[model samples]
Target: MRRQRPIRLQHGTSLHAIVLATAMTFSGASALQAREAGSAETSDTQVRLPENAEIQLAPVLVEGQERSAGQYTATVFTGAEIEDLGLFNSEDVLRMTPGVNINSSGGTNLSSVFIRGVGSMYLSDVTDFMVPMVIDGAPINARHISLGTLDVDRMEILKGPQGTLSGPWGLAGAVDITTRKPTRTFEGYGRAEYGEQGQALLEAAIGGPLTDTLSGRLAVRYSQSEHWVTNDADGAPMANPSNFALRGQIFWDGKQGTTALVTVEHEDVNALPNLLVLMPYGRKPSVDLTPGLYDDVGKSLNRYALEVNHDLASSRITSISSYMNASNMEIAAYDRKIMQAQSGYPSEFWNQDNGRESFFTQDLRLSSLPGDTITWAAGLFFQHMDASYDTPRNTYGYTSPRFRDFKSNVYAIYGDVTYPVTSALRLTLGLRQNWSSTDYDASFWRGGVGSFDSRAMSESATTGRAMLSYDLTPGTVLHARYARGFAPGGYNMYAAQIADGEPFGGATNDMIEIGFASESEDKTFALTGAAYVNWVSNNHLLAYDSGTYVSSVVNADTRSQGFELQGRWRVGGGLELAAGLSYVDARITSSVFGPSDGDILSGNLVPDVSPWSALVSASYETALPPFLGLSSPMLKSIASYSYVGPRPANPQNSLDLAAYHKLDIHVGVAQDKTEIYVRASNLLDDMYDLYGYAVPAANMAYGGMARGRTFVAGISHRF
Candidate 1:
């Protein structure tokens, strides 16, 4: 892991010129619909209220949703239901939300993403990195997006500590994505799918009217799968020959109001698999150990964005600009006795790795357009980043050469205001000011293991937020919030192996949230609940050495509490349901080694947290009229179930982890354009292991293997 390059935050555009002239005069307002003459009756409605009444909500809309760790934020899957769940990235739709967690070592290569439990394991620099990653609307820099799950039109996961409007590193949450625009009529769509072990996929999209003011959209996707780890170390069967994506967009409706939008994207990924440990702890998994499998890992990413909108009358102006570049080269190696037995895993080392990232972002906003009882918004944000990490340790037998540089720059100014005072109470205020600078450089092996410099360091902070909402009626809502979020600190390249030699610092947090929500009507039953607590300071931890697993990055202080519940239901007619639940109580209250320090490793437990997690979904759709070739619409069915618990991979938590479950099924058939599909994931052949590690006596177990149930089919067509 290595990075060093950052300094960006560009804001200008006459302060978003009244939201780019009110998005060019409302850009047709999606076809300006407001005719209620004889009730032509379209679709889309909500209002049920009765789960103990007193709710008045509706004033939150973005793309992408599922955020709760205190500060309520919800949108629960959309973007065409996350591309119909044929997930290929973005941790497979953020592991189904609620508390979020993902640690991988599968055929898709190696994956990592965690929330609530805090992530960036075994240190090497990457302390929450503000968790900011925005596509479509810019802002993306976190070592060139190791996050996946593409083909989106929505994905908003804005949990706690978002630092007023997504600034200040977003603290511990922020995953917003929106892709799918540019449509002037001539619509189009396509899809081809196949599932089980030899997964395959193809996707397409088209736009319309390239004139009348300009409008365009293009999308492409291709995927492949195989490799279920039948290697036995070298028996053959490690697949992932391809995965690709290409996207394009164009929109301009200029005239006096003005509006311009542009976007571009590309992605390529290839992989071999490894890491499926799960022995005693989770009970089953770990078919056979294959030390250091994953012979190849490649990643490529490039993105561009430009947005401008202006509309003044009561206020509305927006501006966003972005750029991203990413690179990954990994040739792995494992099995140091499967990580020295375990007990804190981390063995000597092996390598041939190179990671690079480049990012830039700009955001500007001005708001007002929903009543006048007092509502406001102000914004300015900038980011710049450049990263690098190179590893080397072996050759002749294959590979070595290491280097790392981490550079950064961020600037921000934010504002928020809301007031109602009586009509059922409502008051919200927010503020944010952040300035940061960091520079880190390192060189080794090919560079003769000689360089290491830090020098440049600058930090400024200011954050605030207050909330209170009570609207006991028009739906239902009860909310309470008090906020102070922070996460910005860096420098840790293993922090000199456990801090002894001292070299690693940066970490912070403080948050509080309370919530409640309810809904009915077309939304079919909705409920939300929240409870949270967190206080972390200078907490950049990653100790270890007990059995000599070799790990370091210290600066400890921690506290966490949690509760969250998300929902959606229909349960009738064609059936529809969605659910999420999470509970956590992370600990270590105070550390630098205290609470009876066992070799200075306190209360333990907190490695890859998972106090509890859950998800359940059911779907169904039907339409048939035209016959044979299916002139118009047709079949759709989906099923899902996921559960995770039992976590403790280290921190001397003794040993824990023994809960797992998964089941997925999908079936599709459509018309009016084209479609075809089939899927079955981990059905019954339920041997599981999400991830694990061990060292010392050399214990190794990584399992979550299920390529056992397989079958596939595909087809697609469009204008």
Candidate 2:
């Protein structure tokens, strides 16, 4: 067994300072409570009506607002539910979504979201098969998805290919995040929290009408935390993460049922990747390599968007235009040794990469108003992306200094329609055609020799969807759907040594699914289930060639079949339970990058995919009995458990990770405009690995561990 060291804050910062700061911020805001009291209060009024006046209440809807009768599978999380779950970042929220898995190599921005066994672990700027992330109708890079979740109104996860509606990058699926909009009434909230591991958080948001026909909203968040591990080699904190975000929006309502909104957001983050430990299943080791090597990542993003909507007699027109600028810098030790052997240098070798990306997108769509017989929508999409990067070497000169640039343009047109054949049955169809072009340029120096390369590629594909749905009962529906989706192919900048004109080919998937959803009367219980088979052709797989020390993309065939079950039951008396289960059997059926003709990978499990996963949660909420003369104080308690089964770590299934389970609990009390809560994550302090990587040259396998037990206490005030 390896000896472990006590983890301590390196800067000698006291937790007392954090507590005092939180106390002061909350105390200072108390002065504004009096001014906000009147606006925050709820009142009821009654008035006498005319002799013949009549009033009726509207019907109550219990389902999620973002959900619709559709061919695809999706899950929606409301803002309130997000808050209740204590999710502070996109990574935390994504882990709770059904049929989804997340893996990170240590930093907040170095992460990937796998939807139903389809995702890329390589750098996003170089890969085409990525789970698209959309915020307020604007597409963003995957690296920016880890920004703190502030003032988000809702989040929707669309499963499977969303090509027809979400465009080219939605090859796996899409994550749609809607931020809070300006409200007609003045409302705001402020929060302060202190937690274990030197974690502190502050968040606030305000929204209201600025004028008769204009509204505005603003939100801000800041957080900081020390790393969970210690760098024993240097006696320094392994990972320190800090981030801040700000967002503002304005909405204008014009005459003739026309409305427009403009939004701007900015975020900055700095962090160190998680400390990787040699793995074969044992106690956390005291790593003794890579001393005094720069290991940090920094990222920043700025986004702006404008959306307009106009209502016609029986139709609506919508337009969205967005722009994003993102920049990032990373410095890390590529290889670490206990002592220099032959090389007259330190034990650690360092390298750095800096890059920038700019994106612009425009979408135009028209939709007819809902009708008893038919409803339809048609849209056009155009997007342009430009990315550039520079890599400089400081030690371990295995690769030469390189500079690369990539530019891409995508144009698409799509339409969707649904027609009711009878009162109990419906038919739906969707079609999309997309054309894309990419240009790449690179320059590198190898062994005192310089070389330059440039290439251009073009690709196009047409995808479609068909579905049939029928009502089995008043509150139950069954549906079956078939869909096809594709991802564009591009050149790999790091693989410039490869033969010319041998760029990777595009990938496509055809899927068939059958599902059903039902809810009991009074909304006490609800259930949804789906089974799907996805056959993917020319699937993109990343491979590292030791001979060249370069990573390249290859074409392969894969099959992913899975079944999902989700249910929620209200046990009455303010006690509720929810559970979700998924079984995914994803495997590679054929591969072109085999070691030998007789050793082809024809039935190997897909990497980073778990065969089984599950989540169970329970919550109880009730009114407290006159606590200190407080009126109608509410108390709530919640507990949740999640499991991730074993999974392969590499494409060849050479390494495996064992199963792991996690537990979280939360308790809170609220009265009037104030609330306080305590949350505990990984209560049992379970030790498990979320992901692993094998370095054949070093004869070592590195694993990323799940965070240990943590506790946090927070206070919030609403006005």
Candidate 3:
């Protein structure tokens, strides 16, 4: 039987130092854009901005909010930037952020996210519910919510363990997705794109005020692309499928500073399944290489939110309440030839899994800027989440039909206050006290036999954050911080039926960081750097059993330490240079046990950790001298290389997945209302895999599929 261990916690370990070092170094660097939450302003630093006056404020868009930007190490990508890259999904947009790991299962509908190498218990495309997807202050907690890059004002990737703020699985981090809200003025934008490999995309968004207090916006996106890999067995290329999404929202700006917004969205996908990331195994056909196989997935999302705020004698009170429901269904298969067993019909080799998740959150915050030396915000929050999954045996009958359900309801009150201890030194303190309950149910069915009983578990925690900051000068600041985070533990559907006993484990993480950021607000250059160490006790990790290829969830002591640096500099006329580097050290500090008793994994590098990574980009865009067909202005550009370092495949830390490097170039022409652009990614066509794995005695087979050389042509129109 699996033993349950008490939650473990530590401090100032390897991962914490590494992350702190990186955050400090890049905090002032121009390479990363500061995330703007609420409304804050910062000094302007001109570096590598296009001379087109129209593109005058890229830096301002990134670093416009000085106070908010200085308080947290966050990154932001604007809508204009996403459109310019011709990205098909939000994953494409997130992959560029520092310390972020995004892997997709070859289709638009399935994607996985990892931050700072933390919790990674995901098996298929369904990731752990650690990161909350918030749109316009409404939390989205469903896998079916198609996160396409459409009608977005900006996206903020808040790093570090976010336990103190967002409870439950938010022990890892948070991703705030803010969509384009209705504007007071009539305005809208539309874009269309076509590219190699049979790729097509169309997007449109429009919004305007209907009355003094009412306004609305609607967005639609449709995309399709051909598969990049060709089946070696059937001499056929896996077909790229199609996906679509639609969203509509309306807002009411009530008199006396109150507002409410309602939103609804739906998305669908039809395509082939993901190619299983097998380690080095030769002469084996990929899942996509097989014939008579298909993956069909669908999603539905319904969300409603209401927000209200009022200014009283001494404080501002705000309330935001929302409800969301999401569902996902997938039918897929693995390597049939390799997985065949029993009757050899591959009956038990398939998976039919369905999931339903629902969540509701209500938050109330009160803030006051009583004096120049003191600024504070406090809030009370209540949330409820429920998720259930169903899985059935394949023809092989190696597994039984299984069912699992989980429910959680929580209440929390937290506050953060910043006090100026002196003219140059500031201290910030935050705390969140939470109370919650959890319940789990699991059972199995075999050959007209149903057996097993359900178990219920409950627990609660209080998490918090504390930090200090000091300004050495107007252009530089130094800070130190410590934080605690948490992840809810419950039933594992796959384990409940397969293992001798269902063991559900919870995890806790503690981190410490220190850093400095210095930039000349009026100059053409800036730099930011940080280092951190993080220690995780009962760190939940996913491991594969040796004999059967079946995977299980385990909790092991783990550590990750890393550092990062980013810089941006302007090189005279129309030339800009941006660069970044990251180093992470993640490894297992202890072993995990399966129901069978012996060690399942003694020492393994956790999955999805890229130890060394860097990106270097230099571009020069020149304004055409009013040439032929150029009505308003145009910019032509070429850029250098971007690099992603090797990642380890297994826990023993023996395999080294090859690194990747690619070059790109771009050119654009713009009129008053219309813009046209062309971009080439992977111009050099370097053959490298993003990840690789090893098969027992089958030789090392890597899973890096080259995107090859591709061209994207796109046009955007503004009214």
Candidate 4:
């Protein structure tokens, strides 16, 4: 029924040990960048940075006095840079970045981002991922990244287990997206774009001061696109997709150190599963089938947030509260093809998912100010999440409906302290005590198991981090860190047992990392590199039997060891060159599942992980020469080539997707605040298996793919 699983079925589904672990430090990241939101934790290892940097993606938080300047570089990227790169969506922000990537997951509303080969691949309402996404000061759905960046200030990505800094997620890593806040002075922005595949987009934002003490901002984005694929058999247009987002915010900077921010956002998305393609993805890939009563996938989300803080002479007090509600619906042919059926319209095998989700979180903390010699921050965090979904199937007319209801709560006390032991050496320590519990109920009308409320699952865990940083120079730093990662245990709602539901075990990572950052004296050249390994225990995986069309979830031990190198050089004459490389070796070490899978699946490469990834790019911006007899206008061009190595497609490791390269180029001419540009993604039009699976019994194969070779021209202006 599903490849990313969250679907009704799939035949399903790492570890290392350790003395020393790795903790990600984003200029002293606590709970990823969540610490940047309200906690004032500081480390001298990082120097203040400029706004436009590429390392700023992943799950992070940006707000409050706790937020520090760019350091530990490449962890931050500005909205203007995002626009310059032609990276419009949340998915592109991470996937296109170095040291991080996302596996194939176009068939569902959820996709996971992998950091150094450690991340959750399959996701559902009842399941939690290794990484989490945060916006402003509040935690929100990871999928909201689809909302685009028309109103964004910056994005921050933190790698490694970050449980010691926050709660509920971040067993692997975290990403934070900070939206643009109202400025003291009035400002406005507008952008419009049209492209291939019959697509159009519009974005607008206006913000300014409303009063002496209050400022407000409004932003909106809308996009629509026609069929990206054609039904081979009937030549019918299909796979239409659309998106819309609206946001409003108010910021207050009051007297006596008090400040507050209130935000509201709504986003809607509709898309066809990208998996509706033939598996082999031959030279001329096509669906090859027709006439199915299947519907597309849809999602809606609403979010509300409030943040308040009081700055003290030496310390700061902060509070953040957030609430989110989202709905997901899917009614599609699981097989992605039309087959002869007994009834009219051939509707017997379509799958339906009516899933709903809600999340609420609150964090309060007190900490020394940002520049304190021994900076420290501590906070209390709490969260409650509720999810319920109904999966129904129809055999011509008879329906077999399965329902699942799930609930979870988390409580945590986290703190971090940074101090300098020597003039050139800095040390940071952090700890978090997390308490969590879960309860779930399941129903299978077709299996005769009416409804079963299983036993509740609960546990307590302690995660911690330690790091040492040395200044190679003011612009250069070398660091080492150890961290313990954790994610809560939860029910595999889709593949759970009907009678005695079993919840997958929580996952943990003991990671150790050593890295260095350096730059030239002129600030025109920069370089960063790191090496690390993650030992994952109880990694949740999927196990599917092509013969039975059934799937189950299991836990296994695995390990991922990798390294990354990134560099940038701003050469003379309006030329900038940049490059990045990353490599990971992820392998399963143990197997525990017995029924659908057993010892046979052990010693396999982790599925959906690319072991080698690299990219190189060049950007040039120069003024037009007077020979044209025109006033000064700028000519800009950016080009990059990326290579992603192959990996196994499934838990069984029976098939491996081939390696492929992607090329992107952008060109624009501009003067003043207006720009007209054309950007081409995947210019090579290379087609390779993004995901691959087979039904041995039917002698059939299936997979998903990216939209290859598309061109878009756009104009943007600001005042």
Model 4 has an lDDT value of 0.65
Q: In model 3, what is the error at residue 165, expressed in angstroms?
A: 5.2
Please give the CA lDDT of all the candidate structures.
0.56, 0.67, 0.59, 0.65
Looking at model 4, how many pairs of residues clash?
36
* Residue lDDT tens for model 2, 405-463: 88999899998877887888888888999898998888776887878878889999998
Winning model by lDDT: 2
Question: What's the TM-score of each model vs. the native?
Answer: 0.31, 0.86, 0.85, 0.87
> Candidate 3 — worst ten consecutive residues by lDDT sum?
4-13
In the range 26-85, model 4's lDDT, one tens digit per residue, is: 111111121232233443222222232212211221211121221222355457556656
- A best-first ranking of the candidates according to their lDDT comes to 2, 4, 3, 1
* lDDT tens per residue, model 3, 313-404: 77777777888776666544545433442123432245666677788888888776334346677888888888777775554553567777
Clashes of 2: 2
Determine the C-alpha RMSD for candidate 4 after optimal superposition of all C-alphas. Answer: 7.7
Rank list by TM-score = 4, 2, 3, 1
lDDT of 1 at 223: 79
> After superposing candidate 2, which stretches have Cα over 4 Å from the reference?
1-71, 124-129, 166-169, 280-296, 335-346, 370-373, 396-399, 496-502, 545-549, 594-600, 696-699
Better of 2 and 4 by TM-score: 4
Error of 1 at 244 (Å): 29
